[model samples]
Target: MPEFSRLEPHVVAEILRICETMLDEFDQSYKHSFRLTDVHGFGDFDSAQQLAADYRRKAAGTPESARERMQQFIDALTQLRD
Candidate 1:
């Protein structure tokens, strides 16, 4: 496969667009639900509330951070047009 640097501008733009859409649509939706996930096998919590909070942080943090990073990529890629 060709390296990303070798890809045409349109290809890169389209890839970014598609990725942004996926992040907005699927990723955004799943992230909300991700916070609802159970914290299984991590350890026994002193309370269910603590377990829920821990699960919320672990499950929701990654995708949300990734979404932000993707937005940064999109922004930088867009500036390549300048």
Candidate 2:
């Protein structure tokens, strides 16, 4: 891992902010998925299965996406600082 301690406070703050936004978006997506599942039918196994699949997609996809994004931001900021 990069020595984050060497990074500027503002850079650290921005990283934190980006992470917070990603978390918020993930939470919203999860809630929306649950709501959609409920709307289709509370006891519908198929709907629940679909939701599970979607969640799996999200879970599998989001971290790498977020990491790339954060790295891009870090690279850009580091370049600017340099």
Candidate 3:
């Protein structure tokens, strides 16, 4: 197995933390507006809100999957570092 130290763990942690924080913020925003049944059509805001809600649900339920994907990205970086 490749040594994990090929990648800087702190950098990995920071990137993951930032992604998780952004996703959490997205979840909160979606939860706050998921039930909005009306919008003035100024950007299809209603549909956008619904889409965001769906994405938030998916993201919340599959956070591990997201993290795994991020890990793969980090591994790719490690390859580059090597």
The most accurate candidate by lDDT is: 1
What lDDT does candidate 2 reach at residue 3? 58
**For residues 1-82, what per-residue lDDT tens digits would candidate 1 score against the true structure?**
7555577888979887876765566545554554455546545656866876666665445646544454555566456533
The model with the greatest TM-score is 2
**Residue range 1-82, candidate 3, lDDT tens digits:** 8655564889978877776665666455555443342333345677777776565554444545343444455555445444
Each prediction's Cα lDDT score?
Answer: 0.59, 0.55, 0.54
Residue by residue across 1-82, what tens digits does model 2's lDDT show? 8755586889878887776666666555554543432233335588787876665554334555433444455555445434
Decreasing lDDT order of the candidates: 1, 2, 3
Residue 37 lDDT, candidate 3, scale 0-100: 27
Q: In candidate 1, which residue pairs get closer than 3 Å at backbone N, Cα or C atoms, i.e. clash?
A: none
By summed lDDT, which 10 consecutive residues of candidate 2 come out lowest? 33-42
- Please, what's the RMSD in Å of model 3? 10.3
